[model samples]
Target: MCRGQTAQKSKRAKPYLDAENAEKMGEHLRSDYRDAVDFGGETGLRPGELCGLHANYVDRERGWMWVREVLVARRRVIRSFPKDEDVRAVPLTPKAIEILDRQLKGRNLTHGCGLEHTDGTECASALVFLSKRGRPMRPDGVGACVRLASKKAEVPAVSLYATRRGFATRAAEGGLDVFALADVMGHGDIRQSREYVQQTPTVRARVIAALGQAPPLTVIHGAAGASLGADRDQQPPSETGIEANENAC
Candidate 1:
């Protein structure tokens, strides 16, 4: 089991959202949880990270959010260290805050029912997104919700992390250096960022079509000399001491 580390993604190439579909998926979500897919697909934040967040984490005026803390062990766990052992911040877009606010308000209105779920956590607890029963959401469960919505959204080849990886890749290509991107992603080694490179189909297709020509090929190795083309038959220069064709006296 991977311990104390974020999950490693086997492939880094992420898919892009066809926004129209994403919006459609919102309809499939339970009324109160509708924002789960939207927020996950927008923030590039992990499901756990989002569920773990509180309003305190947002520094809206500054346009960033502190992400080192989480709703773990049934309480907020703020790490002295970072997710990758380095401090990082995520820019807070108007869209992110908007959806978050809607979720919180909706949750509050729903959970005010004065009933409790398994954890006795109110449906409108301190979490950004809540389960139907007013309890903090499980990250895996959130991912499943998003995935299902994506399918309903008709967004093929997309997953929850696509947002996060897409964010990183877009940042990198937008002239944000690897170091800066790494910092924003809470990563220590930018190389570990292979997982965040968004090689969306559009990008990939453009790359190949832009090549416009075939790539250079290398030596045709593994062929025996006897089977080489006539061009390979040029004889080596005879030594001056050998008098051309005379087999020594």
Candidate 2:
């Protein structure tokens, strides 16, 4: 008897919150960080990039923000560039603009670090998102808030990275190509951006519908043992003709 073959289980991608769930999560998030979480969903920015955003980099007139730096959460230090040195510009949505305007209102261009450093000295920087104490927001701290909010919202617990992935998934569903997605996400490789796009039922339906709309293919056969060829312009043969041709082959 032949041995039975086992099918391998496919690994599931990380969970991501859509716009509706994001709003639900926001309702449960601390007011102080609600805008930060919302902005993350809008821009698809990594938590570090979001934390290191500066007033100088925001081009409000053009509706774009440059990802020039990242705050290292563990060391509480600011790096000049983001991961993979993938500095890129993210276009601001109307919602993102509103969030920025609110955060920047009456805020100084620069300030001392809100959190105490290892040396017991404050790091001076101009960061966009800050804690209630006016300190730089850490990725882990934002993640903690997201987890708590997810629980309260009765959604799957997600990290800050989920916000970024959610952004990518939304963009993909909106017909944005992987190349553009990669650029906006500050991904050095297109494959990294591709991974963020989930193949949801809607996307799969779109693909199937698109393929279904294509013109029907016509098969042409030549001499004996000839390979089959498609001629889209050629009309299909009648059933009787098709049977006759098969018998001839």
Output the number of the TM-score-best candidate.
2
Candidate 1 minimal-lDDT segment of 10 residues: 219-228
Q: Deviation in angstroms for 191 in model 2?
A: 1.5
Measured on C-alpha atoms, candidate 2 has an lDDT of 0.67
Residue 102 CA error for candidate 1 (Å)? 2.4
lDDT of 1: 0.49
lDDT of 2 at 6: 17
lDDT by candidate, in order shown: 0.49, 0.67
The regions of model 1 sitting more than 4 angstroms off are 1-21, 72-85, 104-125, 169-175, 194-210, 213-249
Tens-digit lDDT string for candidate 2 (163-234): 887888889878788899999998877777776554644555566568885432421111111111222123
RMSD of 1: 24.7
Per-prediction backbone clash count: 3, 1
Model 2 misses residue 25 by how many Å? 0.9
